[model samples]
Structure formats: structure tokens, C-alpha cells
Target: MAKSQTKTKTTKPPVAEKAADAATTAIRLKQDLRMIPLDQLDFSPLNVRKVAASAADDAELLASIRENGIKQNLVVHALSGGKFAVDAGGRRLKALKQLASDGVIPHDYPVSCLVEDEQNATVTSATENLQRSAMHPADQFEAFAQMIAEGRKEDDIALKFGVSVDLVRRRLKLARIAPELIEQFRVGELTLECVMAFTLTDDHDRQMTVWNAVKDSYHIHPQSIKRQLTETAHSASSSIGRFVGIEAYEAAGGILLRDLFDDNAAAHMENPELLERLAVEKLQNAAKVFEVDWKWVEVHLSVDYGAFRSFGRVYPQDIEPDADLLAEENALMAREEELAAANDGADWTDAEADEYYSIEPRLREIEALQKARQPYAAADQAIAGCVVTIGHDGALRVEKGLVRPEDIPVAAEQTEYPADGDTEIAVTRPNVSPPTSSAPVPISDPATTLRKADGISASLADDLRASRQHILRAHLAADYDVAFDAMLYALCEQALSRSYGTEALNISISPFLAQNRETLHPDTVAQKMLDALEQDLAVEWMTLEKPDDFLAMSALPLPQKQSLFAWAVGLAIKPQLLSDNHPTPIIEEIGARLDVDVAACWR
Candidate 1:
């Protein structure tokens, strides 16, 4: 058996011998190099690059060929009528043709080509295109930066490269990223988007700081990078920035950092303090319109509902309409009725529906005009003030007829008047205690305040107060009946006498503003449930004026009213811990009644 095996091995050939022989033959094939006329060289149908070159690519190739005369020879094969067909370098052929057409090169210009046999033309073309690799994006970025450093103007570079000015600028911006980050991007440790985000600022130190902070985190996304980079800056889309428009901000010498790569991305303002100052100044200027009629005008960059909790609001009253306005209203109502009757049980044309719908808007306009004519009471305006602030939508929000606590009139205890000629009639008012359900009991002793205890520090006292506030809020959130009654009493007292004041609840009929909702409770089950309930409620009442708001609230079902009241009361519940680190008896009593499990609520 061993002798037979040795005998067979003597005649065996190596593996892949056929492939090696074919490769050796291919390498030994003769390639014909010749200088052919540009017009004589035609593109081959067998070329592997079938996609048409873009105008920019063509222009770039033409400029390069015109400047350096073809550095690489194109592969070609002999064709009919003494012409050569280019099997590869289709882009170069196109550029040569363009140069000839533009008279930069003659039609008979000598173009160097490597002539191949027809049988190997397609293979050669495929090998030429498939084997060549495109330049890496990092290399291109650095090349552009090098060109800029060599005293090349950006515009000139763009023109020479056949690219857009914006694109050139973007490359330049990307090149400005920190070298360490660029290396990371080159090595695939960082994404191009992350590097682009770093281009938002030119400060390498800042970029490195952001990169180092995010390098160890799983959330090193482009958006997160941009967010960190512009942490102290304000977005141009923010309410304050919008209030102070980009044009105005720029005119005031504020720098705006824009993402050149993303046209839709929001620009950031480098000077947030300047933006705030501009917003406040504009608000102050806007307040001038209200200052003419109001007793005092206060300008705030944004609305802080907490500051206005103690301020009483005066609603607009309806006035009698003039004869002309009444006639217009009657006509509009008649038209609306006629249109409705015509469209009953049938689809009306769009034009007819539009005409019918226009009647209501006119009626609303008339109603608004009438309401505008109704003046605020002179007595109320004397003691009340107006606030000019930025709304959530970045529009000027003017809240008028806000009476301050100090400006409210107090009731006298007794009254003495002359009733019959020289007879003085003394009428003494009865002393009545405020209702305990709505009125908060005054804390007079220092022991009842939220001050430091025997062993606890001030910070601990604050933390304990905050904890108690959260517990009270949780209890109030569940007890809808108590919340409804409390809100009702507060609203009624403010509306009727306008002299009621309490520390129990800070009930302000304004939208809750939480710049960071997760800062307090990060996605707790209770928060989610409240959010779901709010989403289910009908909130059209928020958009209506005073009388309309009243009508809308009255129209709501009992359940919706209770839900709204609960949500409002939950938000209105503040920390009742006084300075002495002592819990308010009212909050403690409410918590006791509800049987609030502190551990469960915290959980």
C-alpha cells in the first residue's frame, strides 16, 4: 500500500494549477499602448460603468484633464472604421469629449489608451472599475482643509471642484473638528454624524470636552452631542429666541451657530443672556400698549403662574350692542339658518359650505368687537395691574385686570352714620370665623415652621418638606371630591368678594409649566395615569374667553369636571411644611383621611 501511494504521488499536479496557468497567461498578454484622437475614441457598450456621470463630475474631470493632460491611460479595444472603443474610464472619455466641444482640446487631440482585445475588453473594464476604491470621506475632508490652508478661497475651491459652495463650506466645517475625534471617525470609533455635530462649534476644547463626556456613554448620538455642545446656548426655535427673532438677534450682534450639513436643523444662539435681554426689552416695549390703561404694567420674559396665584383676575362683562351691530348680527344669524336649512341631510358644495361657515366667523368678529368696547370698571383698574409676558407660542401675552393682594379692599368692622338729624346710628358687623374647609389656619409659633430641628440641617429640613409635599400631592390626586370642593371654594371666593386669601392651595387657572418633567418624577406610574386621563379630557375650554369659558365648563360632564379639578388641585398642592420642619395640620389631616401609604406613594 505504501509503495502504491508513492507511485501515485509522483504523477500528481498541485491544486489550482489550471487557475495559476490562466493567471500567468493573462499577465503575459500583450497590451497595445497608443495615442489616439479624442474624437476617434468612442465609449464601449461593454463598459462596466453604465451609470451616466453627473455634470459636476464631468466638469471636475474635464478641469483636471485640461490642467494635467490625462495622468492615467484609458483601456480601449479596436473597433470598426479605424476607431477605438473605450472599455474603461468612461468618465475620462466624457470629459475629453466635453473639452473638445468647449475647444479646450482639439477633436484630434492625442489621448493615450491601453488597447485590449475585444474578448478581454469587458473583463478589463470590470476589473478596472471593481478593483479601484473611492477616496475616504475623512481624506477628502482633510484635503479640502489643506487647500484652504494653502490660501485657496472657498469660492475658488468650490468652482474648481465643481461642487456647491455650501458643500465646500460643510467640508471645511467638518475639517475643523478636533484631530482626535477626526482620527476616531476615521477608525470607525465615531460616526460621521457625531463628527458633524462637533462641527457646530469651532472650539476644539469644547468639542473634546463633549466627546470625552459622551465617549463612555451608550447614548453618544449626534443629537446628544449637539445638545451637549450647545448646552448653554438657546435654540433659534425656542420661545425666547423666537420672541427675539433671529434677524433682531443678529442685528444686535448675537452669534448664531448653524448646522451646515442639515438645512432643517435648528440653529443655536450663542448668547442666551443677550437673547433673554432682548426678549425682556421687547416685552417691556409691548407692555407700553397696556400701560396706558392699567394702573401698573409688569414685563416678564415668560409667564410664571406661581407669581400670579395671589392676584385676582377680573373678567370682561357683556355690553348692550348698538342698533347697527344688532342688525348685522341678525342678518348673519338669518344667513346661517338659511344655509343650514339648504344643506340639511345633504352634502353641500365646497363653495356653499364655505359661504355658510363664513357667517359664524363674522358673528364672532362682531361679538369680539362688542366685547372689546366694554370697559373695565374704573375702580378695578385703579387697584389692578397688567402683565406682559411671552406665551408658549412666542406671542405677546397681556393679562389685564390682575388685582394684587395689597391692593384688595378690606371690610370695615363697624359703621357709624347719621340717620336722622343729629342721631348717630352705630351698626356693628358680626365677627365671623372663616370656614375651616377653605381657610388655612395661621401658623404663629416658630415651632410650627419648617426650620431646622434638633439634629437635622437646613437642607434636610428642605428635603423633608419636599417629601411631605409629594405625599400631600399624591393624596390630593386620588381624592377627587376633596379636590373639587377645595377648587370650587377658592374660585368662588376669588370671584365674589375678591378678598379671600389662603396658604392651603395655590390654585391658578393657568397651564402648568415644567421645563423638565422628569426632574421631579421620572416616568412614574402615577404620572402616566394622570397624563392618560388628561389626554382623554375635552380641553376646548382652555381656548375660550371668560364667559365662553364659564359656558364651556358648565357644559362639561360631571366626570370630566372632576378629572380637571383633581388634576388642577394636584398641581396646586404646594409644600405645607412650615419653617420649623413641621407639617401643616391641614395637609396631615387630609393625608390621614385619605390613608396615604407613604411608601407606596413614593414607590
Candidate 2:
């Protein structure tokens, strides 16, 4: 007994912890959940991210707690008076508090807690999640993201939690997702990629549409959702408008300002030219307006494009054309009878109206001078209250303004969201497209044989005269190490050649490439192509009007697989190309033909 006492003494709680334990125990409640008073319970300690009163979760927790007696103690700190800080298990605590309030549980139930500091609230919260893997990745991310927003560096957060920056980024992205979808992910109904794609648009309506579609139609793939959304969102005209950066103008509560605020349009807004056309049409109703054959009048009058409409200061009405312009234009209007006869009384098409309208001979030089004067100034003035924005959000943002990036007001960090995973994802902000050396790969040993090909145009290998020229240049091989491009062309040509029993195949390339500006970055080229294709596929897929975009992939054949490798190799060989950036992908075809140790090459 004496030995046991000494051992107990040796194993006693440390002084610091002993005092903490005593304080914590002092506040402990022995009440059953159904008997405690409301005033005795404090819920601040529990960090409940959501208000899901899942009977299942409740039933499971109650069963576990009754059976296990709260093995994982809740974390809380003391508040002024007798309240406590809640850091976790908020829902369970709520249930207990509710029971106590209803007199089902006692006022003081056995509980656990730790005093958390203001400076360490985030740390405490994040640490709680880290220690317990029960938290969803989204919840953990929100906690970590809170820390970062609270002035913690990403690297510091990473070190504290022993996680990588990428892991942190993914979690942070998950947190940005809508609470509804996030709840789904938390409940194991949705995937992270789905959330990533769904949050592309801020429209909860659109999100729900995609969500229910996924739930009902068995369409879980991100691409299919994106395709469906694109089909719903854009048409040929709207798609083309997107290229000019203003598709949202037609969306609900939308307007395109730059075009609306054009110099001529802005001036004409107050004195809307279409109103004159209307008056003219009214006169035509009374007169024989249909006698005119002027096609110009027919088009312009029909499409009353409201290119100019704005909010803010109204310009004063001016009845007088500048005195000089009025005096000069006196000569322009011919006899009404002769002019009316020329028009044949038809409505003016814009082109026809423009062709028929003649300025006074004396004012031609002055008009030319006015055209040459300050151009960008009007646009700058027009955009003062407006901003160019992406998506059909009511966000009016200004771009390419006189204010430098640094000179803009100290703006709060903007909340940016990516396109919905199901929506045809439109990447509004351009990414610094990296070199398209190959599919994402790492640098492998370059000393190994790297056979280069030209482009994807290559076909089955045939002896090309181009190979001799390259051999003569590189001087490495005249025979075995053939030009991949030449071989690809030969392969393709061979396929075509054999099919038709002719050596020639008519494969025409685009003229656009010929006109492509010299000195363009390869990354830029690849990015442009990728952006176009992504947009097209997204539009086509979303519209539900087009087939799956398997064109680029389907174009390839077994005979052409070698050509794909050769094309990538050519990119890899470029002196400027960081071959390390793009290691070759695991080519199963190549592996089937030759025992390819892709792991070694990738490594």
C-alpha cells in the first residue's frame, strides 16, 4: 500500500494541468440531458457549422454517448460568470441544453472543456478538426481559410497543420462552394470536383437546376452538366457576343456599357435617332412610303439597336447644329420630290440609309477631322459610373481605365467564384496559359533518345524528303531516327494512299495559320486554341444541341498514336521548351508495342 501510494504520487497530474483540471471539474454538471436548467447550459463552446438536426446523427450520438459515456470529450472554455466557450460538438451540446431546459436533464451534467484564447481560436478550431478526422474537408478548409483571412500566411498555416499548400488550397476552394452543396459534400452525396464545377456561377437557381438534374438524371459527370448548362445559356448570336466580351448584356438586369456609351451613341441617346425613324415611319403611313426601293432604308429602320443608353447626368438638349455645320448642310438636302423618288418610299436598311445619306459637300472635311480627333476619351468618360463585368451578375466593373492598378481605391478583397461545374464553365479571367509541351508531366532524363515529330498531322511513317533535310541538319541519324512529322504524314498519307490506292491525299490546312502574327508565344497559341475549344465544346454541350466533343480525340487512330508521341517530342526538343515541365504521359499503346518503363522516364 505504501509503494502504491508513492507510485500514485509520482503519477499525479502536473501542477499546471492539476489546477486546470480542478477549475474544469468545478463547473462540471452531473445533470442528465433532460433535467438541467437553461441558464446553467452554455453553447458557445460547440462549433456547429450547420443546423442539420439529423435524427440519425442525434440517435447515433445519443446511443454512443449512453454506451461509451462520451469518450471524446467536448472542448470548451469558461466564460464570465458560469457560461462556457464552445469549440466543438455544438449540435450534441444543443440537444443536451434543450433537454436541460425542458427539465429532462439536470442543470449540471459531466462535461469537458479547455480555455481557448482569442489569438488561438482559429488554431484551436483547426487543431480540433485535425485531431479528429470526423470533420468534412470543406469544414476543415473554412476553419483554415478563416485563419488565413485572419492574417496567417499559407505557409505558416501549412507548417502548423503539417499539410501541403495544395491540400490547403483545395480545402479553401471547397469552402467557397455554396453552403447547400457543401452540405451535400459533407454528407457524402457530392464530390469535390462537382462542387468546383457547380460553383462556377453564383446563381443558386442554376446551381439547383444542375443539382437536381444530377440527382434525378444520373448525370454526375462534370462535363455533362457543363454541356447541359452551356446549351441552356448561349446561342449562336449570344456565343458570338461572348467573344466580344458582353454576353451578359442580354441576361436579366444586364447592359453592355462600352457599346452603349459609344461616342456617337452617347450623343444620340438624348436625341435618339430611332425616334426620327419612327416619325418618318408615321409620315410614311400617311404618304406612299412604299414607293422607295432604297434597301439601306429597309435594314437600318428595322433594327433599332439601342447601342446607347446610360444612367447619370443628362446632357442638355441642343436644337442647333453647330452654325458652321448647319450652313454647310444647306446644300446636302436635295428637292424632297427627287430624293423621295430615289428611295421609292421603302423603310431604310442601315446600310442603305448610310449609303443614301449625303453630308453637305462643304462639311465633308470637317466631319473627317472630327472622326480623327480624340477617340478613347469619349469611351473613358462614358464608363465613369459603369464597369465591365463577367457573368450575368449585377457587377459593373471598369477595365482599362486611366487609373493604374495601384491607384485604384483601397478595395476590399473581392469574393471571386469559379463557374459552376455543371455549367459550361466560362473562364472569364485569362489564366497565364503555360507551355503546351505535353500533358502535365515532369522532366525526365533528356539524354535518352527523343524522336521529334512535326504536328498532329503526321500519319503512318513514309519516307519524306523532309527527313533528309532534318538529318542533314541534326546530323544524328539519316535512317533510324526519322522525322516524326514526316513519318506521321507518311502514316496518314499511307492510310489515305492505301484506301484510295493513290499516293496523294487532299488534307487542306487553314489559311488562318498563315495570317497568324509572327513572334507569338507557343503557350499563347496553345492557350488560344484550348480556350476556343473549351468554349465551343461548353456551348455545344450545354445547349444540348450538339454531340459530345470527341472530335480531337476521335480524329486519332492506332496508326496515328505514334504521331501524337512524335508531335509532343518535337515540342519537348525545343531549346526554349522546359522539357522538364512536360514529361511524356504513360503511353499504353507504346507500352504494348515496346516494354516502356514509363515509371523510370516519368521519374
TM-score of each: 0.58, 0.23
Per candidate, the number of residue pairs that clash is 11, 71
TM-score of candidate 1 relative to the true fold: 0.58
Candidate 1: deviation at residue 260, Å? 1.4
lDDT of 1 by residue, 1-603 (tens): 565544434532556777788777667543467888888899889998877877766777776677667889888889999998899888888888888888887899998888878999989999998899888788889999999999999888876766778888898888888899999998988987678878889999999998888786522456557767777887776667668999999999999988887776668889978998898789878888877777899776655333454565655545777779889999989878877888582777888778886888899879866877787766557767887877655667677777665565564333445566453555433222222122122121123233424556779668756875796789889997667655654543232212236345785433334556446583666567665865565443432222223444555778877665565455545455446476668877877887967666453
Can you tell me which runs of candidate 1 are displaced by over 4 Å? 1-31, 50-71, 95-110, 305-309, 319-374, 406-603
Q: Name the top lDDT candidate.
A: 1
Question: Candidate 2: worst 10 consecutive residues by lDDT?
Answer: 295-304
Candidate that scores best on TM-score: 1
Q: Assess candidate 2 and give its lDDT.
A: 0.42
The lDDT of each candidate is: 0.70, 0.42
Q: How far out, in Å, is residue 332 in model 2?
A: 50
